[model samples]
Target: MPRRDSPGPESWETLFTGISHLVTPAPGPQRGPAMRELTVVEDAALLVQGGLVAWVGPRRDAPRTPSTRDLGGVAVVPGLVDPHTHAVWAGDRLADFEARLAGVPYEEMLARGGGIRSTVRATAAAPMEELVQLARPRLEALARSGATTVEVKSGYGLDFEAEVRMLRAVRELQSLLSVTLLPTLLIHVPPETGRAAYVQAVCAELIPQVAGEGLAVAVDVFCEREAFTVGETRAILSAARGHDLGVKLHADQFHALGGVELACDLGALSVDHLEASGPAQIVALAASETVATVLPGVTLHLGLPAAPARALIDAGACVAVGTDLNPGSSPLFNAGLALALAVRLNGLTPAEALTAGTVNAAAALGLRDRGALAAGQRADFLALHSPDWRDLVYTLGASPVRDVFVGGERISL
Candidate 1:
């Protein structure tokens, strides 16, 4: 529980002043381009006590604190919340990427044992300590890019033992860093042999052990033509719900199936990767609580079409953005860069993309107190070198993050 660098004084209570622009997205029922009506304050001040925001307003009205740090007129916004990432694994998928660029379809590559399976084999072979060691750098890169909270999925470990290893590694990583990592049990793809038996083991045995040990907070499934069917997704998610674990879905990434509809029916926390989503899916998502989390990193990495970010936003659905960090798919660790991609590639405006990556993304991960820069919320905001927050999206492939404060503790940028 050592402070990463120290946001301010030794007591962890400090006042932050001299912010040029404060981007605080309004708490609401839905998100989109128009709902980007976030509250902006000029020359703002924030009081942090015990790692939480105690007061925020104009500097003239700010109360005295034990310590204070002035940002020197930098733009401060909520720390990035990446709702989808596969951060615990061991392998390289450069060959698969080369094949994908050569016009080999992703599904075909999966069938040929060159995609997730290949990585799963390598991940399964790795020891727990080794997996944790390899994953620390990826999470650190994300933290450096402005992420304070990220959801890490355990899908590369396809079997019970390997999945346990990955989830344990994720838990250990959480203790080792100031950034919070939410672990997800993604029974990624059915094993190459005896898919039914594997599904049963995941549902009956793995879920019990994982839940009993409190290793994961949510369960995820890859519901695609190449992955599990809609029926299988339903069954797995139902078991996860029975164990009181939150539900998430990797739905409609490549092909349009009924994954969105089923995820809505189950009241999932989030439904990710809607690359093939159409008007109907957008409408359905608008009426549901499930956050439509689109990963621009995945689309840009795979050279595929972008998700319907604008449509989902304009339709009143809660939209969020993620890095989709993985080996074979979206392997990038820069969440700020992903935000830029969400603006340019996914058609989300700067304000909308920031909202999606912050408060809405926190909602996707079921964290109520860590998204906004408001009283009673965790003091989790990052400073950008630019005076305007839009510069975060305008400068693609760049890290504008200069400083990061998680729970009032300053971590290195």
Candidate 2:
């Protein structure tokens, strides 16, 4: 008689063992105090077949398989997911950095032919191939920092042609990268002139083209005093919804401006940059299903107040974290640093920070398949150098990732 753990001709591809600890959240977006409830199995093993997790438990009960790879006693957790990033852009923001250091405000820089506009000019001038080349290293750096899935947004290209090129460049990058990429069309800001015309073109021309081509999975709008108003954001998001695209918003970064309320009312997948959010915005987010995504890197770089993450989470809202990797405002590259910063700056516990960076961040992207270490989920996970998974957030200015595996295959860093 065969042992109970026998494969029984199921054709298992790989059985991974030698894990000191396997820590992961449940298979869905965790909210409130539940976010701290991670499942930890000691002396664990994971079975993989067809690039998906087939089974996960103690090695003693592991199924008999033809192949096995020992992981050398490392802690395994779900791969980090970055739901918000403006990773594709050309030109440098060194001058903008200098100006900011000299006490020039960000909005002032935007008003004076700098900030996003400066990158817009450079990114618009670059060919699609050049865009791909420029963005590759940034994505790779994020991947090295333990992000297996990253949402890349095209906001630097505010015009129709340039935006299309940026999305196409993202498509090109998908072929070159091991990390899963989700594309987003970001309506960054109003043009210096033709604000109404630009909004109309985005709704009528760009959104339709992008949706028809399946270039982006979601449409994001920068809803702020310096960007699109709440009304314009509603119009654009409505157009995107009509075309069957998901919606998100850059809300309440520098001003409340009702963007949070609007985003919740419109059912956006997530509302990001809540540095300027208050108790009312917290109440709205807690009442809705929209993920409250906080970018701690922005606070660290811009010297802004941290978002009301503690309040949001305490009010029963689902909170997530990201790097907001960009040129002008946030030059952060490491997703691990983003998680660490969330703990220190955003008032999240280490476990909550990990949940924010993993499953909740995946929720922010409207992804349901790759954020947890469960059967039937994608085999994307990280091996940490220490047995304690909290070190991923505890170790600041350094990475605790020992190895990264996507689809059960170890990726070279």
Candidate 3:
């Protein structure tokens, strides 16, 4: 590797060759303008220049480069894009996990001001620097596990001050790690404040401030029976879109409250946690650009039924996978494990699951340029120590990754 004062096309050097398999892009039905077809070359090679992909093709046709690093017989896939997560918060909820396993229902826990409320309390109490310190390791760990892009939400901090604190922490991590982060302000089902007041605060105060500062890339709302009603959900999301922020919804997790339909109607970037979403919603999503993001870990962790991932994919709906990494429901953060669970438990094919974690996930985050190994796409990808690409999910609990890269730079452990 060499360093230059201002690296340009002339500084382009280094080639990665001898790859056993390369899943360049995961194909979807009729690649739309916002979507692209990823190409996989067998025994492939990639040429990188100035931290960007220069060329990629079969090893035999690999263009000559000044320098090269040959990784013998390894599978190289695009680095994962985890489109949904709630990774920035304080305190552990391991005790809540034990209580849930002991037969306490999740609804009961939330009614007692436990679940999300507990996390909100903890997050509000922690200092910004402390939150940053705690969250840095988790983001780094995701990078080490082959996730190059992840979305961080700000729901734990329900109020303006606390919410901005979480967003600031999310921004700080971006400057410190190799992982690219998409920050979303999750106005998680308001506080004890009245509906109208909460609406006023979010629509009139918080959303504007967040957008004005360019702090959040998207806005999210939890739309369940226990959370905001369809009417309230509409108010929040509509106001968010008014500010030119992309919309996302936490819909159909515990019940089907028409959140999925609402998400499709608004053309949300993605709608997450569809444990109760049905065929009509799936069809609507298939016909729309809104990505159907499924969280199998939440269902698995909560002892609930996983979303119908197979049906959605079968209907030509663009699907994405994510760790709804939160305190009460899903504490699991490993993207590889999430993909494996999606394959066996959520009824998705290995190829479909891979797409969910990669390109589709990137779309869910409103990122148009990343999530594939194309000439113009970012040079972020992963090197797996497996002979076959399918083995990554076929062997559910195993970690076969050897190295992770972002912008053509190998992530340091």
Candidate 4:
């Protein structure tokens, strides 16, 4: 009989041994205490073949393979899954950041055309090639920081032509980068015209066009005081679903709106931005199937109240963390540092943060293949410089990642 957890009939193609610790976050959907119950295997090894994890166990029983690598006691963990980001946009918002730093309120900055609108104008004017060029470096940095998958949004381009251009740019970026891009059509802020008219356009025109052409897999909305109302958001999401697109929402970021209820009611895949959510919303989200994807980068950068991650977890919600990479609020792409912020500001332990950024985030993205090291999962992972995995969070500013592999292919940064 084959030894337990040993490589089987499928010959291992790539063997990695001498790992001090291997963080799998395995047996998917570990909730509450289980999330903290890390699946750390010491003196472990992982075997891969055909771009999937074949077996993970002790090196003594590991099968022979054509390619084998020894890590020399370095730690290994699942590659990060950044479930929410505005990844493709043109222009900079340094002015807005500086203004916010100088006592200018966020709303005031938006009104003065220094926030997302500035990027909206610039992205609309830019060609698709320019958008791709701008996002290439930022995306490369995230790959270097150990992110195997990223969810990109199109919100800066509110109009039909601009939205198409933005999504097309993301299309090009997918081919250019090693990281897997999950594109989302985000209904950012309402258009400059009347909110009613803008909602009509999105519902009747944009969603159908995007979904019909298979341009995006999901549709997202910003439901806030500065964005659409709950009723408007409902219409937009409904139309998206009718077009057979999944739904997500930016809810309760600035107010205690009914957006959370709407998202849960519609069975949206994930509800992001919970800075303004309260105990009731937390309980509701915990009971729902939807994911609570908190963006610590946004809260830390904007000086807003951190999302109640502890409450969400205590209530048994499936919580995931993201960098919310964008030009205005959170100009971030490093998922390693984002995980550190999740630990520091969101009240999660290092193990919990690792689980959040990997397995839980993959669920938020509706991707079941690449977040963990197990049989049939994609061979995406990172080798860290330190033997202890906590160094990824402890050393906040530094990237502890030494090597990144996606689909058994090493990414050279």
Candidate 5:
């Protein structure tokens, strides 16, 4: 292979070559058998201009450019997109972990104030700068593990002021990190007392303030038995839609509470944590545009049943994977490991797992920009350490990503 001095990071146009294989999914969210489809180009070259992909094809047919970089014959794939995560928080859940390990059910821990409520109390006391400082390393760890885009939810701060502070912390982290951060205002759990007042505050005060400040692009509700009821979720999500913010739900993780049907009816961007989804829920998801996002890391950490990913996909639903990175239920930091576990737990093929972590995941976040390595997409991709892209999912306890690029510029890992 021929090599040339790499262009400066600020170069206007650059062509990248020497890829052993370039694997990517088709444009848009894939469903059914299409989810298994991947385009593999041998000896591929990518042309990036102004931080967007200009062309991608065989190197022999690649248009010549003034600046070029050879990736040294490594496999390349679209950078992983983590669409569902609770990545911003203040404290650890070590005690909660121990209790769960001792056979105390997760709901039992939450009811006794050892789960999300525990984190909420700690996070509410932390300053915004402290929150940012604490979350920086976790986001960097995700970046190093092949995640170029991560969705961060502010759920630990359950009250109005605390929640807004949490969103601001996420904004601060965004400026200090290389990965793209999408903030969400998550309504985690209702207060022990004054549940009605809290829901009213979220709809009449928190949603409006967060939307007006441009702090969050989406609003999420935890609709389950131990969280907000289905009726309360409807009101909160309706307020978000009125404010032009997208909606998502943490549903069916422990029991089917009609959250999936409500999400579909509301036209939510995605419904996540479907560990308890049944045939009826799968049917509803398959018929709706809402992406079904499965969090394998949660299953791995909590010892829960895997979400019905195979059934959803077979029924033509768009399926995606996420880390659900959080202190309580899931402490996973690696996006690559999420994909690997999805294959073993969720019955997704390596190709489907890659698509789930990329294009479909992007769709779940309502982003059409950076999931595929094709013209008009952002030049965000990964150069794998191995020649085969499947190694990313096949390898256990290791990351196959050797280098990561965002907006056509290489980022230090």
Candidate 6:
């Protein structure tokens, strides 16, 4: 099969044997693990055509094809999915990091207009092309680190024109990069707009405009103590649903103020930043389809309490992991290292951590065919130079990814 790069299916093509190990992100739990499954095949081979896997089995039992490219003994895994991110923004937060290291708190920094507002002012003042150029290197870095799919949000641009500009930049990046971009309209919290009117504007004006024009696929709200209130979040999300946009939430990052419960109640695709989430919210998430996206990079960067990942996973919640890559919070984009941090800081198993970044993350973003290696899934994956999968997490802060392929097309980094 000829490998395809986009999300949807197309004409068929085929790939012949040369796979050392095929690590399918299949669900491993009996009660349905966060993702579907991970089927491991040693000395395996894959048949790729039309950007999809037509057949996968041991190399000895591989089917013949017209175009077969030998990959030697490289270990293969599905393309990583980063479901939660604030990767597109202006300005830098290195000073905030230094302050935090000097015993300053994130809440304290926010109170002094050093956190999100810093980025807000810089982003609003920046030209859209400049923002795209600044953001392009970040996406290229992530793609080199083996992330094939990622979500970009527009929280820094709080006004209508700026918001449209950010979304348009995202579309431009989509055309420019090999990675798939999932744009989100983040109804940010500005100092000017009051709670009621801001909510009305986002729901009544921004959501409809964004959804109607197909500029964004999802709507996000930061439902926290310093951000939008629970009621305001609900209104924004409700209007987004009416506009047929998927919903996600920046829930319980700094406080447990019913944001997780609200996300579950409104059927959000995922709830991120459960750093301050309570037991009730964990239970609610475990009983729902909404994925719990843990951002270990944010915890590491801000020096805050890590999310209660062990509790959520043990309670049967679908857990995904991401680099909350942004200027103010998590500014890095190495998903493999992020997975390593997830395992060490949050008590996740290596296998579970890998699944969090791959399959569960795809499910979190409402994507179906790109997170795993199966008969019909996309031929998007990475060829790791390491023999052991744990080596990826073991050698943190390093690049073990030797090659990357999206839809059977080799990406030359």
> Which lDDT tens digits does candidate 1 get at residues 241-341?
99999999999998989999998999999999999999999999999989999999888888779999888888889999999999877988899899899
For model 4, how big is the CA root-mean-square deviation? 4.7
* Cα-based lDDT for every prediction: 0.87, 0.91, 0.81, 0.86, 0.92, 0.81
Off by over 4 Å in 3: 1-10, 26-38, 107-113
Residue 70, candidate 2: C-alpha displacement in angstroms: 0.8
Q: Which pairs, if any, clash in model 5?
A: none
Ranked candidates (lDDT, high to low): 5, 2, 1, 4, 3, 6
For candidate 2, list the clashing residue pairs, or say none: none
Say which prediction, candidate 1 or candidate 3, comes out ahead on TM-score. Answer: 1
Model 5: residue 254 alpha-carbon error in angstroms: 0.5
* Residue-by-residue lDDT tens digits, candidate 2, 15-95: 999899999888878889988888899999999997789999999999999899999998999999999999999999998
**Model 4: lDDT of residue 86:** 87
Residue-by-residue lDDT tens digits, candidate 6, 1-413 = 11234443466455645567777776221113544345789888888887777788898888776767777777788888888777778888877878888988777987877877888888888898998888888888888888889899998988787888899889988888877889999876745647677678878888888888899999999998778888888888989999899999998888999999998988888999899987898899998888898999878877779998888888889898999888877877787778889999888887788788887888888887777778778787888887555666677767978777888777766
- Stronger candidate by TM-score (1 vs 6): 1
Question: What TM-score does candidate 5 get on C-alpha atoms?
Answer: 0.96
Instruction: After the best TM-score superposition of candidate 2, give how far the Cα of residue 53 lies from its true spot, in angstroms.
Output: 1.0
lDDT digits (tens) for residues 63-134 of candidate 5: 988889999999999999999888888878998888877989767987887888889999999999999889
Q: 377, model 3: CA deviation in Å?
A: 0.7
**Deviating ranges (above 4 Å) for candidate 1:** 1-3, 7-11, 105-113
lDDT of candidate 3 at residue 394, scale 0 to 100:
71
What are the per-model C-alpha RMSD values against the true structure?
2.0, 4.7, 3.2, 4.7, 3.1, 3.0
Candidate 5 Cα lDDT to native: 0.92
State model 2's lDDT: 0.91
Model 6, runs deviating above 4 Å: 1-16, 27-37, 105-113
lDDT measured at residue 207 in model 6 versus the true structure, 0 to 100: 85
Query: How much does candidate 4 score in TM-score?
Result: 0.95
